[model samples]
Target: MQVRDATATKSVRQGWTGRTRVALVVALVALLTASMPASGVYADQSGGDNNSGQNALNAQQRAVLYNIARDTWKFYSADVDPNTHLPLDNIGPNGKRGTYTSAANVGVYLWAVVAAHDLGLISREGARAEIAFTLIEVAKLARDHGFLHQWYDTTSGHVIRNPGDIDCATETTPTFDNCYFISNVDNGWYASGLIVVRSAMPELRGLVNTLLNPMDFGLFYDSRPQTACNVNPAVTGNQPTGQMFGGYYVGLPVEQGSNWQHYYHNGALYSDPRISAYIGMGLHQMPGDVWWRSWRTLPPKQCPTDPDFSWQGQWPVGGYWQVYKDPQSGKRFNVWEGHYTYPGSDLTFIPTFAGGMFEALMANLVVPETTWGTKSFGLADRRAAQVQVKYTTEQLKYPVWGMSPSSTPDDTGGYGGYGVEGLRFPYFGSGADASHPNLGLSQCHGCATEDVVTPHASFIALDVLPQRAYTNIQALRRLYPDLYRPDGGFYDAVNPTTGGVGHRDLVLDQSMIMAALDNALNQRKLQRHFAADPASAAAHRYLSFEKLSIADTGNGDNSGGDSTGNNNG
Candidate 1:
């Protein structure tokens, strides 16, 4: 059986054969006719009632948002794991359905269920059945150290081997030792799902407890192998010591005596940063000091060669405390780095250019980020998102503005690995910036030169930028209706240069589109539920010590202290 590589693109599938393309074209025609409105006339594209001092979604905006939720809920309802009812990773890329389960996808689905229910899109019985089935299946998962496998076969509910690749095991294939390995962020999403379930369905307390208890968050710290580097702290190695910085190893080997080598460790505090912190603070998985220590122990490095590299942590991001000055323009902007890696040497640390369009927004899905205190990454992240939207629209000229570190169609027919990218203008190479004039990756000179617009990148911004989000959604409905799939969600990405779209419909992305819109429209129900929950409340209480320090240090002023300047829209 053929399984799509789960780790390839956030929402891309393998290349389709000629035969499949013909079939897909036929299916696409039928899908468009059935799903889209015949006239394609949106009710109202005008940004609604700005004079009222409240920039709410217009009528057309609301309809598309509702459709996004309905289409995604319909897919989850129809295409989920038969036994567990969790969303399958992929569906109908080449008319082939996915058979494996994704924990992060399930987490997104759980939130979608809540969103759908709140929006009156699904019946109570339907939502209850979906939630109940998911919990039951999750409870029965073949776990190692109380964590679910990254991928699971739908039929047998058995772990799939190397799910990130084509070597993923089928239901009939025998499971291997590494198949039981844990994905920390994925499990964090699972825990997030359970917490949301418990928040919504109080009667399911017993069932939720059974499902949540086995998640041994404590194992992340205690399970490290006591090697020489660990035992002798004086050894001064790259690996972390004393505390577990972030999520545990990628996959824990099933062998009772498996060493740390078998486990894929992400000891850095910022490795996928938010999920571990979310679950850690929200679930009381570890003590406050442990969490604080993990962050404190984070390694710091700087790049002196590249002036664009700027300070160790600072970037020309729009809305953060740590902002950088564009060496040429002498302007402060809030562009956060995608990563801070020490590739060449210990002292030669280089920070990647930019972050995902929705990386920081993902944490906002559950946490009421604006209320989570100013010192945290919340405000800075939002500002960074605003910067991205502005850059994509003004600089890149995407019909709608949104871009992220996602997959893209390569000049070589196949797709490129994920990178900080977006849709490119036709004349992508005529010195768009004063610095790094010939910016690109691979043979396609325009590859890294321009930004790509995505649906969720716009949808997730609804709360922060309501009128902009509404305008973008309406534009999507009017101009790029082709992106609106029959499944009720937009495709993951689109390249403006080639006019190519992603193949797969990612549950995480779709779920975000739906849930984020719901939060923006309906009093932020999801974030309120997550923030007000006891686990998170306790986590916040314990972290008071660190948060206080954060509050003490403001993001700085325009005199080179603050990222959110008066000029920032």
Candidate 2:
């Protein structure tokens, strides 16, 4: 990871530009109109089509969404150690425990719950109970030191490892007994969680306050450790050990010069500003102090490299490319590294975090009124034109959703057969050559892809379910209108070779995409009926297309031919 000055580029701070905004709005309207059905309008039918009708509809829709969420909660929340409320790691395949208990995961879940409640998906009571349960569990681990551990073994009701340890069992004890051992990513999730929780439980203002206070030990920013520092007498006091490669010594008193001897993995050490920004803006609803300061300071101090200067391209800031220059190599790396798709369903925090940031900004009160458009395709419309652009671009560039390419094996004998076309995209499905439709199925012995159809279906389903873009819903119908099966259930997986549907199990991702889509559709309704904006109407109109032409036909199935027609519907 490299550190660079925030002043490096003006565009970084202002991510959404005027040109991009206009383009997005236009594209979204066009895409939506092309995909949705014309017969059904998203207007409120109750109370003579006035604001009151819209409100009633919004309330009704919220109730329905809440019920749906409640049904799905059972799958995530189960019998954990009552004390820890963390699911046992051994409960699932490969002994993976409590998959959804991390701060980031929980934060997203909390946001979803909050969104559902606000949209009227769950009862107030239901929302409160869920929040209470989560807070209670989090409180159980609120140690005197203030920071939470990386995770708690739900089955054992104990902290399992220090935060960010490569191996959980390697270092059992804390190196520095500080409460804020957590990183920016975890803090972002925590801050977002607090924001939603406080929104619902206003009475918990003090609790929220406690959680927000950075110095009170409630939350601490996990700093990079000086790995080379060790408790060695050779480098202690005045003894000059010739063996001191970097002349660094660990465990030296903070007052001594040795405090600066610790070697960070990367040559640079700086506190992450993004985390601070989220907490300041999202939790406190105020400007961030640390982030602002970091912004002013841009890059931080640089240190000498050691053998331990390892960069694990997994974390959001660490992995992604920014303006920051690599200290070891002056060359610039694109931020899109480590983003290659694989077959398995391994979860990463970057996409979710980025998506959450976008969602939060859209939902925030600070959003400029200029951004809000009265026309269905205007700026104020949540279902703006850019959405279509994003969807289309992502679909074309990435193709598959959810599944990773690495999960598939090579052409030679490996767990899963390799050289499959769709592997690069994040979709999981039965392995078969599209060119050779009669071939037998291929499987990855060690890494089996999750149900394939979930990703595609969920992706499409989410686009239409949300109310922000009635046009999007309409466009979806027009482009891929015939997604629903004859049995009323939508196809989850489709074997392109045989055109078979519903041959896989539905997972949490499927539910999430569906829920998000539903919420987006309901939002569109609110904007149209309650907000009474023309942009909302246009969005609906925009989506009501009769047919969508597939521009790019690369399916990664090694198929040479490209098919485009009304078959999608």
lDDT of 2 by residue, 1-569 (tens): 12211111111113654345334434533443354333222233111221122222255644543443343333333323344434322122233333223444444455444544555545454455444445556656543333344455444434444333343344554453222234334445455555545544443434443544442211222122222221123333322111111111123322355553442111111111233333333232322222211211111112232111111111111122233332323433222211211123211111211111122122221111112312211221122112222333244332322221111111121121111222223222222123322111111112333222122222322222223222232333333334332221232333222333332212223233333533343443222221221112321222221111111121111112211111110
Q: What is the C-alpha lDDT of each candidate?
A: 0.50, 0.29
lDDT of model 2, residue 132: 47
Residue range 1-569, candidate 1, lDDT tens digits:
11221211112213444345334434533443354332211121112222123456667767766666666555554456554555777564565566777677778788887777777766554466556656666767676666776677776676667444443443343333445446667777777777776666654555666667667665654333332221323322333333453344343332244443444334333224446555764455654333433331122222222122222222221122233443323444322233221111111111123345555466667655544534444444445454555446555556666665444522222223332332232223433333423222111233343445667777777766666666777676567556666554676666655566665566777788777866866677776556545655643443221221112223222222222222311
For model 1, what is the alpha-carbon lDDT of residue 493?
Answer: 64
Model 1 RMSD vs true structure: 13.9
Identify the runs in model 1 with alpha carbons over 4 angstroms from their true place: 1-54, 58-60, 164-180, 222-236, 242-272, 290-354, 405-451, 538-569
C-alpha RMSD values across all candidates: 13.9, 19.5
